[model samples]
Target: MKYFIKVVLAESYKQHRNYFNNKMIYVSLFLWPLLSFLASYYSYKAFDLEESAISYINSGNILVFLLIGYMAMSFFRSVVQSAWRFSSERQSGTLEYIYLSPASRLAVLMGNALSSVFESSVVMLVFGILMIFYNRESLHANVVGLVVVMPIYVIMALLWGVFINACFLYSRDTDFLFTILEEPMEIFSGVKVPVMIFPGWAKLLSCIFPLTYALEALRQVTLNNSDLGTIKITVLISILIIVVLLAATLITIHIVEKHVRKTGNIILF
Candidate 1:
């Protein structure tokens, strides 16, 4: 257990150093989200949605609604970033060294996932604070509910990252997978709009993505002032999804490791 803790911390420290050492990453972190948020806000305004529609989607505070949705999207995007990092490790030859280590592979992967979450949370925090300052009037929520829900939300997002990383273990290239998943996830997960407004087919797609539940639970708690009890169904679904993804990730890692052992190569292709 102590060794696992050490690995997590060591990995987190490495990520922390890498992130802070590069000034542009910090700039891009703040700039890209801010730009995207503004673009989304103006685009929605151009549609001139009815006040009732806005209220249904975001409690009538489009700024805060978009802010929270974008923040959640950013958090999930970090998981993809972690997968990209895992792929990069393979390309750089460091992945083989890590695989050869005596440490548990699950622990190493968990460490990487946790580190990505940590970094993403920092960026989200900064953007969230800025949004709050800029649109304080748009903010209305049960603060206590948000506090309770956020930890679980972060865990669910990290589980997604671990699952994606596991999938990449068997692939030589992740670009196609990332490309296919990224936009659909953003659109179907309610990052730019409410899932309630989605078409029937889109709603079905939302059911397949765990981010849908996360965003539902989030908006329920933070925007609607609902307690955990009120969103129990969504929370339960999120937990179930996390469990299933974790199981799949474990199975994938086991299969990949066995193949690597037999073939004596990390990259099958």
Candidate 2:
């Protein structure tokens, strides 16, 4: 276990070092999150809702939902980034060379996941701080609960990342799936609008998407300033979903990897 940690950390550090050397990546890493936040904020402003309404929203209550919803979206971004990046490397035959090394596949995946995760977290933190300042509201929530729930969300997201990477390993064309999933998630997961606004059927469908639970969980912390006790139901549901989805995702990955090898199409691209 200790050896594995050292390898993963070394790989992750190497990846980070390479990323830092790329100027475009560094600029995009800083700009994308701020741009996303500004885009959402401006879109809302364009609605011309009264200032009073907007100010009330800046309150910790409403801002928390937005904060968490974006965070959940960040997971989706991480997975897509990982999948595509991996696929690109595979297409260039670089991934094949990497796999020949003695390093663990999980360790390599962690390195990839870390690259994307860093970008996503940077975006989230930037947007969150901006929201706090814009609202001029001091935020408070269950610090302990936030800490507990975050790792679960990351685990869930990582499962999806694994599943997607597995798909790319064989099909090498899951970009369509990624795009389709991302668009709907952005629209229906209550990122820019409240889920309450969705009709019953729409809300039900959206709930089927994992991002809904993530957004709701974060909203509990950001908007309601609620503790773990207050939001136990949502947390419980999220925990259950994460467990089931992760298990299924991992199984699918194993099956897919084996299938690709058997078919000799692991490099399908």
Model 1 quality (TM-score): 0.90
Error of model 2, residue 20, in angstroms:
4.6
The CA lDDT of each predicted structure is 0.77, 0.66
Candidate 1: RMSD to truth: 2.2
Lowest summed lDDT over 10 consecutive residues: which window, candidate 1?
A: 51-60
Residue 14 lDDT, candidate 1, scale 0-100: 72
* Residue 143 displacement in candidate 1 (angstroms): 3.4
User: Over the stretch 164-209, how does candidate 2's per-residue lDDT look in tens digits?
Assistant: 6656665666667677676787788777777776889889878867
Instruction: List where candidate 2 sits over 4 angstroms from the true fold.
Output: 17-20, 46-65, 98-104, 130-140
Cα lDDT of model 2 overall? 0.66
lDDT of 1 by residue, 155-254 (tens): 8988888888777776576557788677899889988888887889989998987888888888887667788788888888888888998899899889
